[model samples]
Target: MGSNPAAPIEVHDLTVAYRKKPVLWDIDFELPEGRLIGLVGPNGAGKSTLIKAIMGLMPLLSGYVRVYGQPLEDRRELVGYVPQRESVDWDFPVDALDVVTMGRYGRMGLFTRPSKEDYEIAMACLDKVGMADYAKRQISQLSGGQQQRVFLARALTQDASIYLMDEPFAGVDAATEKAIIELLKELKSKQKTVLVVHHDLNTAEEYFDWLMLLNMRLVKFGETRDVFTQENLRMTYGGKLHLLSEAAEKVARQ
Candidate 1:
């Protein structure tokens, strides 16, 4: 275990299951602060499950998760999460600004409305993501990339020390992908820790300083240079040849 009490995230003996079928088993890792980390694995390998368990959004079958050396409940305000785009209900009645303002709910009391400062902050975040012009647009009316940007702005409004995002780049134009990565780098410059669920093996090392290769277990977790080896990729993907070749070429190019 890390001796640093302020490690961004720590999980010990963590396990989670669905319908009595284990998805994550005895997962354990302690993350350092101020880095962009990527969680990569094959589909159904429990990548999203791990993030949910860490956020306390799922019932853990056993073990525990700690954030900044405290239980998630005590550190809720310090963490922010952006769920997968597929998991969100874009049809719900809300405008872009309204969605971003919801991020401030954590700082509010029950039944309290957002104050002026909260709206200001939300607008600022929206502007940061280049969605300020669409503040009044309905969420469902926006393009996929625009919707994703709105969600990222919402996470930014929380101003959290740690942010966990699930597949933020799953589907988007190249410009949007580039913009999101740039925003993530900005967060890193502020010494914020970010863990992203990434699907593209070819870009994993290019995007993150640390890589966590998971396949229903903690296959490998460490600096990207050390953990992005061929053996680790094979273990994580069960010898998927094409992906391996692509990743190898990416590494060679770098």
Candidate 2:
């Protein structure tokens, strides 16, 4: 809905499903440019599926997704994806820098070796995530938070304009979460767009500017404060949680 010159990621009448069971339906929304938008919902809510469909990782049952006014594949270098921690095997034999270099593979094309410039870019990404010191360490040695940061660094090395993250906070520690938030805010400041799949309701208000509530059926999506109210929360979370949160907020204010 924003009229900004920088085009945002737009999903129009988007629908996605698995085995003919509809997971998302008639989902229409515009993720404004330069904001940290959180996609919140319970398990099986299709939060991850939403990002996957946008990124072209999954087939769309219907509708269309556009990034910065162009389709996803057309701007491959402009889209970065940080999948769930469980998405990859931890025992893989790769160092932090080694992992970051993969981000440049798209620009370098397939089966080609990384040039010196690629290594420089990867190191810069490591520095961005505060993992420059751990560049030599194997990924398996990292804590959950550190591992997520490494993945973030990988995405950053790609210099993408749009970021789609699936539950980046799931297993990370509080400290790491804070660090990641700081990094994301920096990205927003640079006019890059970030959409995260999140679950912690307590911190949802503080973490995002826009909120998309999904229950495998496109419950809601809009400005965070507007859509995260008690009425919408009930529809998104449940009636009991709405009552509890309302009471808690009233008590805190009193």
lDDT of 1 at 187: 97
Which residue runs of candidate 2 sit more than 4 Å off their true CA positions? 2-6, 238-254
Deviation (Å) of 190 in candidate 2: 0.6
Model 1 misplaced stretches (Cα beyond 4 Å): 240-254
TM-score of 1: 0.94
Per-residue accuracy of model 1 over 1-254 as CA lDDT, tens digit each? 45777788989899999998999999989998999999998888999999999999999999988898899999998998898888879999989999999999999999899999999999999999888999999999998999899889999999999999988997887777988999999999999999999988778889999999999999999999999998888888878878667766764565
How far does residue 15 in candidate 2 sit from its true spot (Å)?
1.4
List TM-score per model, in order. 0.94, 0.91
Please report the candidate that would top TM-score against the real structure: 1
Model 2 C-alpha lDDT per residue in residues 1-254, reported as the tens digit of each score:
76433466888899888998999888887887788999987667789999989989889988988777788778778989898989999889998889888888888856779999999999998988889999989999989889999899989988988898998988788788888999989999998889999877788899999988888767888788888887777787566785556645763554
Candidate whose lDDT is highest: 1
